[model samples]
Target chain A: MSTFMQFITTGLRLGSVYALIALGYTMVYGIIKLINFAHGDFIMVGGYTLFFTIPAFMKLGLPGWAAVFIAIIVCAVVGMLVELLAYRPVRKRGNNLTSLITAIAMSFILENLAQAIPAIGPDPRVPYMLFNNDIKIGSFSISVATLITIVVSAIIMIGLYQFTQKTKIGRAMRCVSEDKQAAVLMGINVNKVIIITFAIGAGLAAVAALMYIAQYPKVTTTMGATLGIYAFVSAVLGGIGSLPGAMLGGIIIGIVQSGTSTYISSSMADTFVYLILIVVLMVKPAGILGKNIGEKV
Target chain B: MLNIKDLCVSYGAISALKGISLTVNDGELVTLIGANGAGKTTTLHTISGLLKASSGTIMLDDIDLQKTPAHKIIEYGMAQVPEGRHVFAQMTVLENLYMGAYSISDKKKIEDNIEWVFHHFPRLKERSKQLAGTLSGGEQQMLATGRAIMTNPKIVLMDEPSMGLSPLLVSEIFSIIKELQKSGITILLVEQNAKMALSIADRAYVLENGKISMSGNASELLNDERVKKAYLGA
Candidate 1:
């Protein structure tokens, strides 16, 4: 029972990080109808940003929480720049193929940038529990860092929900996604909305990075590599473009990974995750919450 | 309030609006009526900047709009309530209304505009929280109109607002158009139902095969033999 509890605890933590990154992929895809391959590098950038800023933040007598907030904002601003210089022109031309290739190029550029920075130590292993102390209950132990991640994630998701449901900007996003020409006629600047979308998604990925490093305590040029794959998988498992669907898919995947790893060898754990994805695809190709996208040819 | 001189718009090699020229003074509800494939919708689309004019000029209060991008056109005091009532599907009715005022800089003015929209479309108020995609056709049309009005443009452009609506809803929509005109907002109206389009219009233009075939006072055009046969089905 205690062993089972460990899996549950660990699964939730990993799942939470995957879900946050997945939100980035799903959101960009939802609005632009193209996968932002550069999104993975946004995660890597977040880790490195945190790495360099932590010392300065500590020197300034800022708390761990403040440091995380600053880091996320900085990363978000960097994300906005990427949108402006890298993605916007391609998007404006309405060329999906070019946008895809541009995103991939941006991802590699970010990863290389991180490697070029000194004292980032080439492969900066993010120290575990750098901020949070742990909480133990009955023979099972859980980190306060993980708890913080869960709480912060909940707040972010809620904020996103309200933004999309109650605001003018949110409505504009929906209209543009439905029909770009119609939205332009309504005076909704499709380009500005797309830029904001990228900023928000990248910011959330930064927050996820902080929480993620808490458990793993490792950050390298490729820190986000495996998680990116997993996050993409989680997004596909959920309905692409369906916000709630991504959340559900993440949790399901976490539980599956944990449950399988606990019972079987850890080497086979990834296989279990893949198997579940296969089952989900076989059962419902659009995913658990995906709507069927139609093309009028 | 608006003038187009020799306006020509095309898609690829095919001309959609060929040297169409017309004028709509301020405080007038002008309608363009034509059959399917006739250039009615194209003229509106070009004016609203949804489609570019290949050659010609669009001037509203002296703002040259020939080279302006689509979203910026609204900033020049024009808003389009598009065809198919393209309300934001996932958004609530209230949220859709807010989108109309998106570019407005004044917070208080935006708030007042929302209240005014709610006042004008009381049905939308009742269903304010319902997702617009779930709205009935008429309600969607109402939301579309309210959304445009939120921008508080000097002029509103509507394309086939009555399309896909039942007869009763069509009447309701026309009444709303009348109400907007009474408030002194210049309107550019396009429709397939020429009789209904001409009835409320101050001036009417007939478009055929991508050009303006005739222009006259709405009541006068309604009685013309050609207009009567093609549009009124007389």
Candidate 2:
């Protein structure tokens, strides 16, 4: 039972991170109907920001966690820049293929740019530890980092829900997603809403990156690649455009991955995760939470 | 007042509006009537800055509308009820009205505008928490119009508010439009239902093939031989 509890904790921690990253994917998809293949790189960018800033801050006798704010700002700016410089021009073309291709190209550009940078290079560096202690509870132990990951993710998720439901800008985002031209007629600046969406999505990704490296403690250019694919699958499994679906999908994928690795074999973990995705697709193609909206003529 | 002078628009090589001119004086309800593909919608879209004019000018109270972006055009106190009653399906009716008041930042004003919409559209008030998609066709039309009114615009540009409705609902919406005009809102109405549009409008313009073929007082145009033959199906 304790062993199972341990695995559950691990699953929840990993699931929290995946849920955060999936939100970035889902939101960008919701508004623009683009997959934003570059979304995963925002995590890598956040990771590197932490890698560089954490030590620098500790050297100045400040808390390493304070670096998170800087990383969030950096990721947001990078996300907005990616949207403005790359996606906006293609979006103006109003061709889905062109936008998709652009998103993939942007992903490659970010990955390669990180690889080519002299400071970053191809080396995998260990991130500074934010929380190393663990809490002991009735024959089961969970790391402080794991608890923080789940709690923080839940808090952020709830905050995001409130923002989208209660705030004016949040309503505008939904409005733009529903009918962009009608949103424009309502005096909404569509471009500004999109830019803000990218910012928020990428900012959440930064938080996910912090939680991620807290557990794995690795920073590499390609680290986000696998992580991103998993989150993308999570978003798809949950329902590509639905926020709750992304969260549920991430948790399910995380549990499956942890369970497979714990009981079956580490090597079989990914296979099982992917197999579940295939099975879910077969059964519910629109995703678990996705509505099957008929295409309007 | 809205004044559009010699506006020209094109979709690449295909000119949609070929030098059309029109005006809506303050406190006047002007209707632009035409058949399908006669550029009535095009004229409204161009005026609202949705589509750029290749040449010519659109002036709303001395502001060069040609220079304003589509999103900013509403700040000049102009709102459009697009042809399809494009309510945000996932949003509640109340939320849709809040979206209409997007540009207005004052909290009290927004509340008051919402209350005003609720007053004018009591059905919308009752379904305030309901998702817009669930509303019937006539109810959706009311929500759309109520949404535009939330902007509190000096001019409301309505495109086919009666597009798809029962005859009873058609008369109901027309009566609401009449009430809005009596309450002192300037309107530029575009419609294929020429007979209904003519009956309510103070003045009218007959658009054919992207140009204003005739312009006159509404009652006179209603009696004109050409208007009756071509539009009224006399």
Candidate 3:
């Protein structure tokens, strides 16, 4: 039972991180129908930013929380730049194959650029520990860092839900997502909404990165590649464009991964994750939360 | 006031609008009557900034609408009820109406506009909380018109408001449109139901194969022998 509790806590911690990153993927895909392959790179950028800046902020007598805020802002700007520079030019043509290729290229550029830059190099660096304390309850015990991650993830998710429902820009996002041409007729600046969607997704990804680095304590230029793909799988598992689905899929993937690593074999964890994806797809092609929307003739 | 001159549009070698010229005076409800593929929809699309004119000038008051983007065109006080009542299907009727007032930021004004829309289409008010996709055909058309009017546009470009509706619903929608015009909203209506459109419009233009084949007062065109043979089937 104690071992089970340990795995559950670990799963929840990992799930929150995956859910955050998955949101970035789901949102960008939801709005523009672009998979945004480079979205995962935002995680690496955030991890590196956190690794370098948190210590510097500590030296300057600033709190660790300030570093998280700074990383989120920087990563958001980077995401917007990716959209403006890479995606915006080809957007007018509305060609899927070109956009898909652009996304893949963006992924490689960020990975290679990070590796080439001496300051950020390919070497892995351990992040400064944010919470060394642990919370205990009878037989179950968990790290304060993990608790913070779960709570922060929940808060961010709830805030996002409210923002989508209440704000004017949020309504515009929904309108654009539903019908781009109709939205245009309604006076919505579709490009602006797309940019903002990328910004918000990347911002959330930064928060996920901070949580992930804090738990794993390692940052590398290539980290985003695998982690990003896994989070994307989680997004698909839950329902690519559905917010609640992303969260649910991330948790399910996290639990499954932890279960495989703990009971089965750590080496075969990814294989099993992909297996789950295949099974889910075979049963319900639209993911768990997504409804089938047939195109009107 | 709207003035379109020598407008030409093409879809990669297929000319959709070929040098069509027309004027919609302020407060006038002008209908563009034509069959399918007659450039009626294209003309409205060009005026609403959906399609860029290959060579033409669309002047709305002092601003050149031809140069504007589709989104910013509404800022110049033009709104379009696109064909098929393209309401945001996944959204609730209330949310759909809020989208109509997308450019307006003042909270009070948006609420007021929504209230005003509900007053015009009280059925929409009852279904305000319901998803727009579930509404019947006639209700969807009403919601579409209500949404367009929610913007308080200077000129509402309506594309086939009576499309895919029963005869009863057709007359119902046209009457509501007439009432909207009576309330001082300028209208540029496009319709394949030429008989109903011509009967209500102050002036009308006949489009055939991407060009304006005829233009005159609505009643005169309604009585013309050529219009009777071709459109009215008299």
Candidate 4:
């Protein structure tokens, strides 16, 4: 029973991080219909920002966690720049194939750029531990990092929901997603909304980076690749354009991965995770929560 | 108070609008009637700044519309009810109205405008919380009109407000357009249904193959032999 509880806690923690990252994926996809392959690299950017800023802040007598704000800002700026310089031009002239190729090219650029930077070479570095304490329960203990990750992610998700449902810009974002020309008729600056979307998506990836390091504590140029693939799978599983779907998909995937690792061979965990994706695709191509909206004539 | 002269638009190599000129006086409803692919939608799209004009001027009052971006055109007291009633399908009717007032920042004013829209569109009021996609076709048209009105613009460009609707619903939507015009808003209406458009419009222009083929008083055009044969089905 305790063993089961331990796996559950671990799963929840991992799921929270995946959910945060998956949100960035889903939101960008929702607004632009582009997969934003570079979204995962935003997480890597956040990790490196923290790696550089945490020690600098600690040296200046500031708490290491203060670097999180810096990481978020840096990632958001990077994300916006990527959108403007790399994606925007291609978006105007190209079809889905062109934009998709641009996104993939962006991902490669970010990964190789990080590797080429002398200060952030391909070597893996240990991240500063933000929360190390654990809470003891009957026969099982949960780390402070795990509790904080789950709680913070939940709060952010709720905040995001309210922003989308209740705010003006939020409504505009929804409008743009539904129909770009209609949104323009409503006086929405489609480009500005897209830039904001990239900013928010990248900002969330930064928070995911924080949660990720709390558990894995490793920073590398290619760290975002695996994490990005997992989170992308989570987003697809949830229904790519649906917010609640992404959250639900991430949790299910985390639990499945944890359960498989604990009971089955650990080496077979990724295999099972991928198998679930294939099964879901075959059964429900639009995903668990996605509605197959037909095109109107 | 909207004017367009010699407006030409091209989609890559193919021209959609060739030197089309028209005007809508303040508080008057002007209808542009044409068959499909006759540049009616192209005219509205150019006026709304959605498409670039190859040559000519679009003057909304004193503002040079050609210089304005698509999103900024609404701020100059002009809005469009795009063809197909493109309501935000995933949003609620009320939320759709809120999006219409995207240019206005005042909270109380937005609230007032929403109330005005609700007063005009009572059906929309009843389904304010319902997702727009779930609404019937006629209701979506009403919501689209209400959303454009939420901007409180001096002029509106409506594209095929009667498309794909039943005869009963068509009359209902025309009545709503009549009500909107009676409220002193300048309107430029585009429609394939010439009889319905002519019945309500003060003046009319007939477009064919990207040019203004004919222009006259709406009722006179309704009686004209050529218009009757080609459009009125008389």
The fraction of reference interface contacts (C-alpha pairs within 8 A across chains A and B) present in each candidate is 0.69, 0.83, 0.81, 0.85
* Pairs in clash, predicted candidate 3: none
Off by over 4 Å in 1: A59-61, A112-129, A292-297, B67-69, B105-120
Q: For model 4, how does the per-residue alpha-carbon lDDT over A225-294 read when each residue is reduced to its tens digit?
A: 8989989999999999888888988888888889888888779989999999999989999889988875
lDDT (Cα atoms) of all candidates against the true structure: 0.83, 0.92, 0.90, 0.92
State TM-scores per candidate.
Answer: 0.90, 0.98, 0.98, 0.98
Q: Chain A TM-score of model 2 versus the true structure?
A: 0.97
Q: Rank the candidates by TM-score, best first.
A: 4, 2, 3, 1
Worst 10 residues of 1 chain B by lDDT: B90-99
Candidate 3 structure quality by residue, lDDT tens digits, B1-234: 999999999999999998999999999999999989999988888888888889989999999997788899888898889998899888899988988988887889889988888888999999999988888889989988998987789999999999989899999999999999999999999999999999999999999999999999999999999999999999
Using DockQ as the measure, which candidate wins? 4
The stretch of ten residues in a row with the least summed lDDT in candidate 3 chain A is A288-297
Q: Residue-wise lDDT of candidate 2 within A1-297, one digit each (tens)?
A: 987987898888889999999999999999999999999999999999999999999999999988999999999999999999999998997698999999999999999999999898588989998899989887788899999999999999888878988998998999998899999999999999999999999999999999999999999998888999999999999999899999999999899989988899989999998899999999999898988764221
Reference-based lDDT, residue A34, model 2: 97
Between the candidate structures 1 and 2, which one is better when assessed by TM-score?
A: 2
- Runs of candidate 4 exceeding 4 Å displacement: A295-297
Q: What does candidate 3's lDDT look like per residue over A159-237, in tens digits?
A: 9978888899988888888889999998999999999999999999899988988788899998999889889999999
Candidate topping lDDT: 2
What does candidate 1's lDDT look like per residue over A1-297, in tens digits?
888777887788778888888888888888898787778778888887777677677778876556677767877888889889988887778598988899888888887877886766476665434756779887777778777777778778778877876677876777777777767876778988988888888998898888887777778888777888888889999987877877778777887888888888778889999998999999999889987743221
